[model samples]
Target chain A: MNDPAPKTVPLDDKDFRDQLVAIIPPLRAFARGLCGTRDMADDMVQDAMTRAWAARQSYAAGSNFRAWMFMILRNHYYTTLRKNARMVSWDPEVAERVLVAGPTQQDGLNVQDVQKALQKLPAEQREVLLLIGANGVSYEEAADIMGCAIGTIKSRLARGRVALTALIDGPAYKDEPSDKGSRSPAISPAG
Target chain B: MHPQDSITMPEETVPERGLKSVKETVIASDDPIGKALRRLHDEVVAEPIPEEFLRLLGEIERKLNGAVTPE
Candidate 1:
């Protein structure tokens, strides 16, 4: 017969709340990367933080804090807004037109184009792209954080890049008009 | 903390000269995405963590110290 595992020191509510607060910055940063707007992400994270704090006993000590917290926040985000409502614009009819709109064919690659293009990507693809490409998170880490397979992360990253490239090359993205002598020198992509 | 917080350009190539004119010559680098990517990165750096977030963090901290509820 095996003995029951030794007990550890119990965390009072205050200690648990402190732990949740400490993780907020990175949590907020990650949430921001997912939701596309600061206000929504903060709201999502705050709700998750509250939920986690209230259910503190469920979170085992010495576990993956970032991953656990992220799961809760993400769940809150999804539950609050279903995919359809979120994809639509404030103008009800605009959502229909927006669906068929691909990247404009002649915008010329620029940051503005990229941002616009990214907005069109599916939420999953966007999440993977932000986590892996912009934020420099590892595939395994993202997979763990997202509760998906590493292969899924790689696939989303590839697809997201392709979609973004198409948007950059499309006509909708307008290049910033620059004067002959005043345009800033282009920096290398390698940088 | 928004989803687009770090959204950046595709990347570009830069010449030795810091002058804006030099930017006209370089596009993406061998890496192909560096130019746009770097600019976006700079933008992210420029964005301070939103004050509302800081306020919330402060509030949470206070709650931990027995100062208030989730306000």
Candidate 2:
């Protein structure tokens, strides 16, 4: 008997699942940021990934796996929230702690602080911000994923930008980047 | 379930790299805190809850195939 070997499939299907699983780290971060808790994000991403794997053949193999997966996840996040409105923290500190894969302490700068800061934005705003701000999905793609107009994504992102500026410019979260490296300049998101 | 039917997309063709700038700039921008924020963002987005998540995924994949599990 074969020892759990993957059944022979189209090269595309096999490649797609491999890529899909690789994005788990980033997907986890997005889910946690959106849901505001580790528990919920875990569920969200698991749901999304499962859907993605099962639906891999539906995926055009050459397409951007990141955006395709985001569409699935954003769909799940909004629909589930609407049905039973699970409140997730927008505060980014909780995010950092929630998504840790390894130790972070080269300098005094704490990764956790960045997470709490991300969590501060409103849910809708945070969704765009993470999608565009981090993963690099276009505003249009993000809008499509969120089932909203591009203009709406732009508006929410603007509001999110203002909120983040106010926080990072001040001590909204502990362990600001300056606290870690005296030489490292502070970062400003231009979005 | 039919393998082809299980796949999900609005259409068969997904635009090829229509938005490369977003990920590059978003992930780039030598901006320190934005970088920091992004680093944190990437980390929590996954939650790397050790091996539990992977195990669950394997189980789901097996179940979908109608494979029997040992009691």
Candidate 3:
């Protein structure tokens, strides 16, 4: 197991609260990537933080508190997922529309495109990618948060990267054949 | 602590493939994908902490302080 051994530390409420507050942004960002919208993602973060605070006694000190909190957030997300199975947004296109709305477009088209590409990934793969690529979380920590082996986390990262690349660059390739006027869209869109 | 933690971008280790060149370009320091991901993190960090969230945190703080629970 890649899990860190829990270190002993007398619980300091002020320090604990500071740590919790510090992680809110990344926590919310990860949630946004998972749920595909700011409001829904913040709701997930709120729920997870509440649960984490309530269960403070169970949290081990000096071990990876971020990962522990992430697990809580992920668990809440999945529980909510199970409760409303029908509303799971399967269509990436639709997801892109929903997630990008309300957020200011001041970040430029590149950010916008990447966000869209991210939502295009499968939830499992997307979560791993965000945990590693975006949030700088370790694979071991991610695997622990995700309740999977490190190898599984690696595979998801690989697959997610490939899919993201394809989605991001696919349009340029599609335009090439059409611009050449020598090939049709259906035959060479993904090439 | 795990070896995989050292592995940030899998493309660095994965054998060269048809998309290897393109993938390298995409993951480059100045690449949009990388920038976008960074921007996402930055934007989140820049956002003001919501009052509702702060209130929630205050509630937790109060509870942690052993304050009597208000019915």
The numbered model that scores best in DockQ is 2
Candidate 1's DockQ is 0.07
The digit string of per-residue lDDT tens for model 2 on A54-168 reads 6665565444567777777877776677677436435445444464465464543355554565666556656767777766666666755665565555556655655566665
Q: What is the DockQ of each candidate?
A: 0.07, 0.18, 0.13
- On DockQ, the stronger of 1 and 2 is 2
lDDT of 2 by residue, B3-70 (tens): 21121223322222222223333533764544555666656654445476778667755655564555
- Give the clash count for each candidate: 41, 25, 0
Model 1, B1-71: lDDT tens digits are: 42222222211111111111111112234333333433333344345556775776677676667744455
State which candidate, 2 or 3, has the greater lDDT: 3
Runs with alpha carbons beyond 4 Å of true place in candidate 2: A1-12, A89-114, A168-191, B1-23, B27-33, B45-49, B60-71
For candidate 2 chain A, which ten residues in a row score worst on lDDT?
Answer: A176-185
Better of 2 and 3 by TM-score: 3
Model 3 — TM-score against the truth?
0.69
**Local accuracy of candidate 3 as per-residue lDDT tens digits, A85-121:** 6434645555555433334445444665666777666
Which prediction has more favorable lDDT, 1 or 3?
A: 3
Cα RMSD, model 2: 11.8
Which portions of model 1 show Cα errors greater than 4 Å? A2-25, A87-109, A171-191, B1-46, B67-71
Off by over 4 Å in 3: A1-10, A90-109, A171-191, B1-32, B66-71
